[model samples]
Structure formats: C-alpha cells, structure tokens
Target: MPNQRYTNQRNTEAPMQSSIENLSRAIFTVNRHAKTAPDPKFLYTLKRQALEKLLAEGKATKKGLHFSKNPKNSRQQSDVLVSAGEYFFHLPPTKEDFSELPHLGELNDHYRNPKANMSLSVAKTLLQQYANYYPTEDKKQPGKKTYQKPIFKRLGESY
Candidate 1:
C-alpha cells in the first residue's frame, strides 16, 4: 500500500510538471510570433490572458517592471515582468503595478527566451484552451458602407 501511494504521487507530479513546461513553450512560441504578426491584437490578448490565469493559479510570479523598448507617442512606458516555468515574459502594467512592483529599469538585450519548437497554430490552440479564451466574431452588418465625398483639385492653382 505504501509503495502504491508513492507511485501515485509521482505520477501526478510528472503530469503537472510536463503541463507547465508545455504551457511555457506554448507561451514562448506565441510571444515570438506576436512580435511580427500583422494582426497581433488577438495573439497579444491570448498571451496576456494565459499569463493572468497562471498568476491566479499560483503557477507564475511577478518579478518586477522594465522600461518598454518601444514607447508609444515617444512617451515613457513600462511593463511587468513575469516568471513561469523557467521562462520570463513582460505584460502590460496596470495602475497597481506601478505602485506595487519595483522598476527594473531597461530590458536586458543579451538575455533571450529559450527556443521552443512548437508551431504557431498549436501554440495558439494550447493557450486558447488553457486561458479559456473564445474569440467572438465581429458582428458587422453585411453590405454596409460609409460614403465619403471625393476631393477634386483645381487645375494649376497653388491656392
């Protein structure tokens, strides 16, 4: 009976460990592709939702904040650093994050995330499942077009 209990405990731990690893890999793949994706809104949303779920489950930790490399409108910005399963990622900081987490200054260019071999589609699917994210289709009315007046330039007039 003692031996059976020990084996059962080990069995449960193994799957949990592997699941975390798989999730981390999926996150890495999603993050990588999101950087260059033309329509990255959905990808970024998926990553953020997954990280939030992991944090809520006590599977991930907030490390600190780092200055964003690409600030919008030339204004300064920062992101929250999160650690999970030997992987690190940055999430958009909330108002509380500015007060609660210490700023880590600039991002480390030398450090890189571990290489993951998962496909983009697989990664998206895995994250969607884990994050419980269901994308809703945009409900635009068919054949609806807004008309714009055409601008005509006067011939040879600098006015």
Candidate 2:
C-alpha cells in the first residue's frame, strides 16, 4: 500500500509543496518496473497524459517525473495525483514485443503495489543492475543437444 501520508484527509488540505515531493517519491517507486521491463509498456492513456503534462511544465527528465496528488480520482475515484507519463498509450501488443493486454493495463499492474514505488533515479539504476545480472549470454551449440547447466547459454561451455 502507498504511504498513508499521501492520503487526503476529509477536512484538511495538506500543504502542496510537501505533498508534491511525497508524490514524486511515491510515483517513481511505483514506476520502477516500467523502466526495467525488457520492452517497457508505456502505452497507458493516463501515463501519457501525465508525461505530456509534466513535459509541458518542463519537469520531465530521464530520472525524474511529475505526479498528481491523488491518482485515486481516476482509478479509485478520488482526487489524487497520477504520476506524469502515467498515460502515454503504447503501441498495441504484438507477438514481436509481447502478447498481453494494452500498455495501459501493463503500466497499471506495475504500479499497483505501493512497494513498487521507488525514486526514478534509483529505479533506473536498479533496472540496469538487473539487466546486467541476467545478460543474454552468448551460446554455442554442442555437436549434440544438452540442457543441464543453470547458465545454459554461453561461449564454449558444455551443459
């Protein structure tokens, strides 16, 4: 779940500046998966709206993003900030990229968990690490087929 601090109180309006910061951190964390997927799914309509709006505000950056205060308004039906770029619709899924629902559902699922939220900069670094860890190792087929090694694909390695 997202930090309750981000929640809106019925009678009190939280300070905007601090709320914005909280929203930033929260949004970044939630979008971490979006940054790391082999082929990112950034096609959601809401994400695109957020991205364009932030870009217009000159707030878009490789590591930083602008977010709405209470995103629930659109989803849970509450007035909340949806992170910028939260709605850029991705091209329709294809066998070439993936076989699934529209990018909107993909991005939404990534950010569905509050734990998913992490600062964009941190998320980017973490994603890079994950990619490096599971690099596509080169593979050489033996005269005969075999699949016994955990690291099955690599140069000059026998299974």
Candidate 3:
C-alpha cells in the first residue's frame, strides 16, 4: 500500500510538470504574436525587466501598480462667447464638415446696398428653426411657430 501511494504521487507530479511546460509555451507564443514591430526584441522580456525594477523600487506592491496622480486642469479657460440675443450656436470654420446648400436668390440687404450675396440657405433655415423653437424668454414659449421674414428677399421684395 505504501509503494502504491508513492507511485500515485509520481504519476501526478509528471502530469503537473507537463501542464506547467504547456502553459509556459502558450505564454511565449502569445507574447510573440503581441509584438507590433518587426524588431528582434521580445516585449515580454522588456515588460518583465520593467516590472522587476519597479518591484525593487518598492513602488509596485502585491496590491497593484502605483504611480503619482497627475494634477487636474483647474485654470481651464472657456471658449469665446458668440451670442445672438440670449441664445447662440457653435459653427466650426471647417467647410468640409458641413455640406453647402444650393444657391438661393439674393436677399435685400438693409444695412448694405439694395442686395447682398446669400450662399448659405442652411444657416437661414437653422436660424428660422431656432427662432421658431425659442422666440424669447417673455414673448413666446418654445416649439411655437412664428412668422418671420426669409433671410434673403428680392432687391425690391416685400414680405
């Protein structure tokens, strides 16, 4: 019975060693595949060395990796304020991000001469939408349609 117990222990030890060897080979294969560059250096070896150095420095403990926390941006400045009355919108200067609408006829320019160029009909539509949704704080509630003149009218047009 003692001899049988000794044989059983040997049998279990052989399989355990083979299992460990298989696990190590699998780890090496994964480490090789994780390499992004075609360089001869193994990332696993580099990571192991770095971890050993950190451990020696007492910075890394059994709990987890530790490092100094970075300071937050407390003095971050706000963007430029551009408003139309109480409400305003942000439009990026990049042209490619937005699609250009087809040309609508020129509208009457009260400040300038008789008429001025109107290339952006979408802007007019957006402004109209905003005006419709948010007329004013005291005047009208949001989502109520309001009668407003088109952004562009004919040279002698009246609406």
Candidate 4:
C-alpha cells in the first residue's frame, strides 16, 4: 500500500507562506486572523484559493474539499467565504495555503473601463426599465389599452 503522508505539513503550509494570508492580514484590521477575530480578508483568501475546488452548489461546509458524509481532514482543510455581487459563499474553519488559483474578473476593468462600460444605449435602457415601473394614468387614452407616465419621476436626467 502507498504510504499515507501525515503531519502539521502536507499539501499545506504556514499562513506567512501565502500571498492570500498576507492579503488576508491586510484586508482585515485584526493584525492576525487565525489568532484574531473573523476578518473579511479570511473570506477573500479562502475563496481566492478554494474557489475552484470548494464549490458544492447546494451544500455548505466547514471543511475544504468537503462533501456528502465524508470525514474531515483539518491538516489540509480550512473554512472560507466568497461574495460575488448579491451571492454569498462560505467555508467554515478557514485556513490559508494558496499556490494555485486566479482572481475572477481581475482584468475586466482593463478594456472595459468604468466609462466605457457605461454606454448611452445601456443608460437609456436602464432608465426606460425603471420609467415603465412607475404608476401613472394615461394622459390621452389612445384606445383604452391605457399607458402611463412616470408620476413620481426621478429628479435628475442623465446627459
């Protein structure tokens, strides 16, 4: 049988060895995470490293690479959390050791800068959506089908 590797080291390392750890420490004002309280950096680093391998879709875990009814392995496991827009992901009992993983949308703002992403057409469409949601009586009912105006209109106009 193959030898089972085991110890305080195996596919994992000290927190100081990872950029994620360093990043975590910086993101959180705690100064020291594992030794301190819960920090947002703990979330970022955990997700930054485990995002690819930690997805379970319908379930949550306090362990890395965890699922079903399997046993826990703290030596190579750590809890983590991730947030994408309104969505939230979590990994309890977080640890740090990231050598593989890439940030999502890291360069999305490059070609599509803040100003570039905001096009006149898109602005018009968004405005129209909210505009239609307003409650108003038709000034001149064309044929009883009825149309409405923005009775409570937004105070400002976009260019």
Candidate 5:
C-alpha cells in the first residue's frame, strides 16, 4: 500500500515548488523592466521587498557577495548575492554582511537569469501582493498651490 504520509508530502511539495517558480519568474520580469524604466523606484522596491520576505521565510538563501559591475563614482562596491529557486539576485549589503558572507569577487558575465515569459503587468501584480506593497499616489491637494506668480512693482513703488 502507498504510504499516506508520503503522498501528502508530495502533494504539498508540488504547490510550494510552483509558487517559488512563479515568484522567481515575477522577480526576473520586474528586474528586467526596472533597468530601462523611466521611473523604476516602485519596481525595484517591489523586487527588494519580495526578496527580503523570501529570505525571511527561508525560501531564499544568501550565497555571498560580488563586486558591482557598475560601481557609482567609480568606487569599488559589492552587493549581496541571493538565490531563490533556480535564479540568483543581488541586494545592497548590510554591515553584518561584510562580516558574515564571504566575498565572491567579480560577477560572472557568462551567467544570466533564466528567461521568464510572464508579462510585466502580471509580474508587477504578483510582486505587489507578495511584498504587501501598495504604492501611494503623490497627488496634490485640491486647495494647495504649488506655485505663485510674484507681484512686480515699477521702480521704488510701494503699497
């Protein structure tokens, strides 16, 4: 007879695997768009938050650090490497990361994230839900004035 416990475990594993796969694909899509996006703040934030949540849940693991390819101001820098499912990502390193994770030196140019077929909208939605992020609109108050025309007076004229 088939073991009941084994069957139940197998059933549970399937869903977990699919969810992880979906999350990885969503992350890939978000990252790809963020690179060329005019305003990528929200996209990047979603990716970071989702990865952090996955790390906290043990669904992702930190591999180490890698030298940033495009360091700002031409200064040497590094990023924390994280692995989720079959994909890898980089996050800004913390102080503790310097002492904890080993430095992996330069990033490998030959390696690339797996191709993801998900649409940008779908990926954004999935990440927004997973990361529990709701973007706040920067709407101006109806009664608030953003600018005012300066009053001009000729010569030394005064009221």
Candidate 6:
C-alpha cells in the first residue's frame, strides 16, 4: 500500500516536472534566438543627401575638390573626391589610415564616434590634403599621385 501511494505521488508530479522543463526550454530558446536592435545614431540617409547637396552646389568646381570613393577600399560609404583618376583620399580615414593621423586626434575620435562633432579646421585640412595631393588635370602631372596598390580598374568607377 505504501508503494502504491508513492507511485501515485510520482505520477502526479510528472506533469508538473514536464511543464517546468518546457518553460525552461522556451525561455532558453527565446534568449538564444533573440536579435540585438540596431543603433539608430548613424545617419544612413543623411550622408547621401548631404553628398548630393554638396555636389549640386558645384563645391568641387569652386573649392577644387569633390567626394568620390576611396580606391583602396571600394566598399566605403563616404565618398572621397577623385584626383588624378584615383580615389586615394578618404573623408574620415579608414581604420588602417586612422593610425597614421595621430595628430588629428579630435577628428579621428569623431570618426570613431560619429555622434561626436569635429572642428571645421580639421575637416578642411583633410579636404585640403586630398586637393594638394590630387589636383585637377590642369594643375597635376599625368603620372603623379598614383595609388599605392595596383588598382584593377580605371579611376572614377564609383563616382
């Protein structure tokens, strides 16, 4: 009779144990499969609009510079002006180039943290560097300002 009562108790607990296991599995699955929400700080659309507006104003013709794409890296979103038929310039230097401009700490920091604002002078300096390095056809030599690496295609492919 005692064994029969123990068996009855065990049978009664089976459903509760099963329910607890199911609940644990559901929670584990939810947590394991959960996705992280994307950060909204990056201006995905504004960058393009800003570029278009800047180009439409003919800033390239007057300032002697324009935004294109970095030849060294074709997949970059921000455009660096084309010069001597090469995209040697990057608006905010890529991770590889960031270390080179240690003096421009504020600008580099701003690049790393997009939310942070950068000084106008630093921004101008970057643009000026590109302008000085890659002048227009009238000002630059045909062979000057070549890409460090062998570019597979002709320049202006992305711009």
Best by TM-score: 5
Q: Deviation in angstroms for 6 in model 3?
A: 78
Pairs that clash in candidate 6:
68-80
Error of 3 at 116 (Å): 51
Shift of residue 17 alpha carbon in model 6, Å: 68
Give me the overall lDDT of model 4.
0.32
Question: Which regions of candidate 1 fall more than 4 Å away from where they truly are?
Answer: 1-18, 139-159
lDDT tens digits, residues 81-114, model 2?
A: 2333332222222252223222222123344433
* Poorest 10 consecutive residues by lDDT, candidate 2: 97-106
Per-residue lDDT of model 1, residues 15-78, tens digit only: 2223777888898999999999998888889999999999999999999999999999999999
Instruction: Give TM per candidate.
Output: 0.75, 0.22, 0.17, 0.14, 0.77, 0.19
Instruction: Say which prediction, candidate 4 or candidate 5, comes out ahead on TM-score.
Output: 5
Q: Which pairs of residues collide in candidate 4? A: 79-91, 79-92, 79-93, 79-94, 80-91
Query: Between the candidate structures 4 and 5, which one is better when assessed by lDDT?
Result: 5
Q: Candidate 1's C-alpha lDDT?
A: 0.86
Q: What lDDT score goes with residue 25 in model 3?
A: 32
TM-score of 6: 0.19
Candidate 4, residue 88: CA error in Å? Answer: 0.9
Candidate number with the higher TM-score (5 or 6): 5
Report the lDDT tens digits of candidate 5 across residue range 79-131.
Answer: 99999988999999999999999999999999988899877887887888788
What TM-score, to 2 decimals, does candidate 2 have? Answer: 0.22
Report backbone clashes per prediction: 0, 31, 1, 5, 0, 1
For candidate 4, the per-residue lDDT at 76 reads 39
Relative to the true structure, candidate 3 has a C-alpha RMSD (angstroms) of: 32.6
Tell me the lDDT of model 1 at 10.
32
Per-residue lDDT over 111-151 for candidate 6, one digit per residue giving the tens place of the 0 to 100 score: 22112132333322333332232223454446667669765
Q: Which order, best to worst by lDDT? A: 5, 1, 2, 4, 3, 6
